[model samples]
Target: MKKLIRLFVFFLMFFIPASRVCAFSDGDSVIKIIYKRSYNNPPFPESTNNQYIIIDGNKSYCLFGEGVRGKDGKIGARVDLMKDFGNHTLYFMGPMIPEYTVNDYWSDSLPAMHWTIVNQFTTIKNNYCQKAVTNFRGREYTAFFALNIPIQDGPWKFCGLPGLIVKLGDSKGIYNFEMTSFEKVPNEYNLGIGKENGDYSLYKPLFKKWHLRRLEKDKARREADPNCLDCGEGVTVRYTFIENLLD
Candidate 1:
């Protein structure tokens, strides 16, 4: 009976199509994503440097955003994509560097999304495709995909679909993202949740009182300031909308 079961399993494994193998397990992998930003009101559309997102299983994701406008370091956010538990962005000053602290609670997620196919002939990486749409963060985006690669993962917090998200952007024609190429994992990559024996399972606490107050003050100041640089007085403000890969 044992021998029969083993033989049946072996036969099934050999019969599955090669394309089905693109459905990756929940293991670790390093992916490279090229990002670009644009502004409709100001009419400045340009491509910027690429970034990296390392999926460290269920605990963490390391996002390395680079380019003239991007932060130069990697931010180790949770798999949920919220709460700055590590030293990333302006939240951590020089004195706070090298120290790790978890935020009060995590509130972000790349939730399971519902996608309706728009078309199936949109070319991506020269492959036959299916274009679909989904909404996130108060915005709706049309994404082009190909079912040949069955993995639900893609750049940024984009996930949980029938195929790899090759490209996506808002419907009003604001921001856009697309896959450039694929490569071997970098040497600096790590598969562990914390990359080492450090922050995983144990994180220092961030004082909510001080942190929340600071965040509120910062928001108020930003709202008061008119961020438009050279625009005329008639224009209230010029907004630079960023398609946060971390979102």
Candidate 2:
């Protein structure tokens, strides 16, 4: 009997495909919102990306719709944002090196928004939403919030409104976020992560400026390497980010 149990354990450990292994930690979310972001960076056509925000009370986790792993079985160059509104901290993982390293985690204070409520209303997903505007991190944003939900949260650290932000966009038309789906997930639905760890130990918190500098260094390295797969020959690179903070 012991021998058979040992064989079963061995098979379970070694025979299962790595992809089948779940990377999400044991945390559950009550509400999940999917946002479609459309944006354009100069030299490249406007592209659309999808992100998921799972909210459980005063905390939420955000990640790309698809998994963060690359074809080469390495962590891709992506940023995952997690907000702990209870603590007033916004945690972000990355500036990861595609097919390379998973960088350290850095955090900054949750963005403070001074919102001006407008006397405008529209219906979205069966909920009546009101218009509000605010300037966040250098971009003027217009948001529509649904008072019915009563959750003080929204996609990508856009919170503190009277309710959930159903739609958000910047003034330049460079970035727009529209919620595609909102579902009340089961309690068992894992929030994916309680802390930042990418196949490695939980990363210690670092300064945001340090992380930004590392990102710049990584960008320079790729530009210098002519054979870089991410940036091919004659491709004019334009560096643009969602957050344009004045130094």
Candidate 3:
């Protein structure tokens, strides 16, 4: 009985988390996701401020921007969407660093309005701009701007779209993100305030803290071995904002 009980408890613990992670409901609206960048690259050496917007029916949600500059001097941006509703949490999935340039600074201003591929490839009548693209690991990507929608904006310097950004990333596979699915949320989405004039600024300090922490950890590892080839290197970065916005 004791052994049986222990085995049952173990199975329960293992399956519970796994089930929660994998159990996704069907019939929920599905948004196609594509990472236009590479995979696993750094976040600096590309553009700085990034932003995004999402429009559902007539309602829209905007997330502030966030930026990443890895130890290797690679830069990338991140935009948040509504919280995860089902089994999947909203996430970026492309290269995180830049591939070509060394220092391409983006503007703090927003983008023009435009439609996404998902939005039928139609124009939304806003000012959209191209940000930057960088190679990371080995892939390539481009970032863009969508400025018509005002409600959706987030951390980093990511912004300028009609609806919020549904996808973003670079070519080298460093950083990538997309909205897989979303449900009607009740609370009013608010853009917090700070360095960038909103909650997105919070990620600035957080990125700094994490970057420094990683640097220290990597430095120690190098000290112990002295021959880590991947220790430090800068790469190119790029950004693109799809004109159609969705599809």
Candidate 4:
């Protein structure tokens, strides 16, 4: 498997058609939450990335609002992270390289976040929210959840709360996610990946163990290549992965 992945890394110029991965079609998206995500990846602080979370009946999909925005300002079909609370499963898809157009995905059981709801209270976007804390993956997080939302989920692997998390930030203050807007979709939305008729068999399944391994290889490549254009002279390079790679 490692050899296969290494081959893909080097020979990725050869096109592999992406598979059409479908989202739950049983229900329409009831609500969508837009989050203003800010994080520090070292060498850079307070980096901003917008994220969106769409809630269906018993499933939710969270994805970056990068390539999925249409010219009409509506969301296009794309799925980055999907949570199926009913099945206790999660599907993580990412690193959408335009050259390969290969849909890379991985699946694992939902993480068990033992959140402790606190007595403290606050309001976010006019919603009454309460404080909750939990140790997820490797970081301790303080989250503010909206009681009125009545959804047990949030941005980026935060769930098991009594309501939707309105704001989340790690203890180190390196990462912060806050809900900016919430709205109900006027029509049905199907979260999907790749073209409609694309071959699902071509989708690559990435194992969790290989994630760090791949990163290390890329790091070595970058370090050895003095001509790497991403880094200029005197520019300091550092990496701070959002989640513990080991987890």
- Give all candidate RMSDs, comma-separated: 10.9, 16.1, 19.1, 16.2
> 2 or 3: which has the higher TM-score?
2
- Estimate candidate 3's alpha-carbon lDDT, on a 0 to 1 scale: 0.34
Better of 1 and 3 by TM-score: 1
State candidate 4's TM-score.
Answer: 0.70
Best by TM-score: 4
Top lDDT: which candidate number?
4
Lowest summed lDDT over 10 consecutive residues: which window, candidate 2?
Answer: 17-26
Model 3 alpha-carbon drift over 4 Å, by segment:
1-39, 42-156, 188-247
lDDT of 3 by residue, 1-247 (tens): 9999967854554454343222222222221122222234344453333233433322222344323455655333333333222222222221113321212111122322122333223222222322433332233534443323222332223333333343456443445554333323222222221112223233335434555565677678867865556543442223333211111
**Residues 45-159, model 1: lDDT tens digits:** 4545453444332322434443122253333333323212233211111112224233222233344356677755566774345788787655688887655554455555566
By lDDT, the candidates rank as 4, 2, 1, 3
Q: Report the error of model 1 at residue 154, Å.
A: 1.9
Query: Model 4 segments beyond 4 Å from truth?
Result: 1-29, 41-43, 66-75, 94-102, 193-233
List candidate 2 segments past 4 Å from native: 1-29, 66-79, 94-103, 189-233
Q: What would the TM-scores of all predictions be?
A: 0.51, 0.65, 0.27, 0.70
Residue 173 local lDDT, model 2:
87
Clashes of each: 0, 1, 115, 0
